[model samples]
Target: MVFKDKGRVMDGFYVTGHPSVPVYVLKSGVIFDGGFTALARHYERDIRDILGNTSPEYIFITHSHFDHVGSISYFKSVWPDIKVFGSVNAKKILSRNGAIELIQRLNNISRAHLLSYGVNDLYEGEFEPFLPDEVVEDGSVIRVKDGLEIHSRYTPGHTRDFMSYWIPEKRILIASEAAGCDDGSGYIISEFLVDYDEYINGIKRFMEMDVEVLCVGHRYVITGDDVRSYLLSSLQHAKDFVEMVINILNEENGDIDKTVNRVKAYEWDPRPFPKQPEMAYLLNTQARVKLIASKYMKN
Candidate 1:
């Protein structure tokens, strides 16, 4: 199922995490049309619609999620000069997997785990992939024209390689998926089951920024006076959610299924559901499970 078109492209969508930042209609195209309903290349059309014949100079990805990177190759095909930047680790992942294989994996997995919330059909078939020409490591500054620098801070915990971009000049902070989400409603923030600690710290890091505008991945941009408060509330909720799950696991004597179910039972903000769970949760779960298994193996 696809997210209903709230309005035409450019209709103001409210971002949740930070209330002070206003989002422009930079792009309204969906790489994954109707949440993976079609196998065709819809993103090309989406970009054309939003850009209206103007090619974008920079495309910044939050991570290596299939949907986020879906149209990357197409963008490269159209504009040879366009530069695509993403977390350094994501670039490594792309380098190992040929673009055709990557797209094929996403296409095939499009509808595999519907029982899992936010599961959509992955892309199938072979498509060209655009390997990043440059990797932006954590703390690296991405300077756009005229001294607008987007600082790439490594905020591990989402994924080992996830980085959040900070603009000190405009005081605009683009958390990618780091700042949680706004969900275009009143205020909706995302909670991940990944490294709850890194997730928490990631949110707190934004508080230190003199950020007045916040743009998060997968939701409408948010801007307002209550940005900081709302973001903190979201962070606390994630902490509590993870802590409760850990506590329940301890009580159950390490019942993995129960732990998973308890974590799942926590109320997920509906708005972010369709676009999640983020890649961080997938990676974090694997990492934590490995850590748990290692302990038992050693014992």
Candidate 2:
């Protein structure tokens, strides 16, 4: 399921993918990817050439993670006149907080990212991180073209400000990392959980929608009425997760890490969960804890 052409349907609806990079272009010339890289030794020209080479009128970011946003600078350079859109929180993070610490941490472990791009992949030259030019919050509608409307819906279980896109006209929903990834197998791999219930609710929102196409961040996309049915099934899995975590916390007196692994065992595919067990636990624990914490905090 490699996305080779400029525009092609994965399940249904136009999309494109990069070999090491993740690039998706819509039928309306809306090009979207998460990041930009300047290292040509790796592949592709500087961020400048990648954006300049394409005719994408608009750019939408799924989240502000390093991989997802590596080519943002390229788009901004070529389409200085075009608008770059991302979650409002992502915009604020780029503008207000300098994520230097986070970048360094990611680089330390991102050997694969470097190897994929090829050669001295670490930021060596006068490299600068790509920042969003504009912000689009939850429920914001992106008019890709006439009759093609992509709606930005907030689903913060992955990251606090993460969002997924929906197109009502086509009944297609891009879940980003919200609904998690279903390998050809029976289990699901989650990106990270900032809020388990909200993530489940987000999945439910899309499942309830009149969607026929469901494109996620990675892996194969699912379509037809079966999309909603699968989503509902995923939601049940998540709910069972919440219940399992609750039971574990009660037994171990809030052992977050222990509870996280207990849940991870339920995953069908584990490669996407990352190697370091602690890192995996850290990513998944916060999501469940936050979901429970919010329940108590609500008035």
Candidate 3:
């Protein structure tokens, strides 16, 4: 799908062949969120068709999660000199040998699942090594073209490395997972793997922007008058989830599994793709449960 604001043009493609992997391309040839390598390799031709020209000057990564950046190598294979941008923490995560191995493992799992769904055009190469060519901090403006500037907003809850992008001219905010995954049904599947507090704060920061178009990291994109509501509702979801987790733990007498199941009843909305895998979601829920417990239940 494509949208135009002012004179700037933006188009979205499932670069990774999964609804969860959104790669937004600007007319200036800047790509947002490269997605996983295996899926990206599978859909490289389709992605190239969308861009018309496969080469991009820069690819901005929102976070260093395996899903978000597993395909960094794909672009390098196409345009070896394309500059990659990400948060400092993301730079560190992608630099480690163990992290690369873990990312590759995650890539394989996603590939198999996608193939079962009949997406058979995936490429034959293995995921390649990557280290961000540039580490971006909050308040950085990357001038990819003469009149277009990409602004970075550091949102470090989805991961300490998350950084969402804003384009002032288009009033577009590529909110990434920081605004939570938009379930294609007006709901944000809030993810707070590291810290609930930071997640909430990040949502609030997005709310402050004059965002006319909110491009998520996944299935749906928000535009028109609905952008504000999306951000507000996403904030509420996070607050509600954290409160529910804390309350459930207290009521269950600190039984983590029970609390997870109870909270699952509320958080799990079978909307569509872009939702985390069940195993991944449960693991994240467990981490969130334990984090909140240590902070509040430890009296």
Backbone atom clashes (below 3 Å) for every candidate: 21, 13, 2
- What digit string (tens of lDDT, one per residue) describes model 2 on residues 1-299? 32323344542345433333446555565655543243322323332234446556777887776556654664455457656788877876655444634543453455444545453644443224656666788878767665688788888878776878877877767676787765445455544456666777788788668877676665556667567666776777666656666776667566666655665665423544223233434555566555653553343
Which lDDT tens digits does candidate 3 get at residues 1-299? 32322222344322334555656767576778777676665445555665576477888999887778877788788778789999899988888998787777777877776666676766555667788889889999988764889999888887889999998987888887788765555556777788878888888888888887787777666777777777788888777777777878879999999998887777774445435656667777888888888878877
- Top model number, TM-score: 3
TM-score list, all predictions: 0.68, 0.73, 0.88
The 0-to-1 C-alpha lDDT of every candidate, in the order given, reads 0.52, 0.59, 0.74
C-alpha root-mean-square deviation, candidate 2: 5.0
Query: After superposing candidate 2, which stretches have Cα over 4 Å from the reference?
Result: 1-7, 10-14, 18-21, 35-54, 78-80, 96-100, 113-127, 190-192, 261-281, 289-299
Deviation (Å) of 126 in candidate 3: 3.3
Residue clash pairs of candidate 3: 37-70, 42-122
lDDT of 1 by residue, 1-299 (tens): 11223223223222211121112223322111112212223444444555667665676666655545555665566766777777668777667656446544653454343335442342343445556667788788866654466677877655565766766766656675676655455444443434656777888888877766665655444455666776786676555545565576677677766655444444332334443443334444445544443444343
Worst 10 residues of 3 by lDDT: 1-10
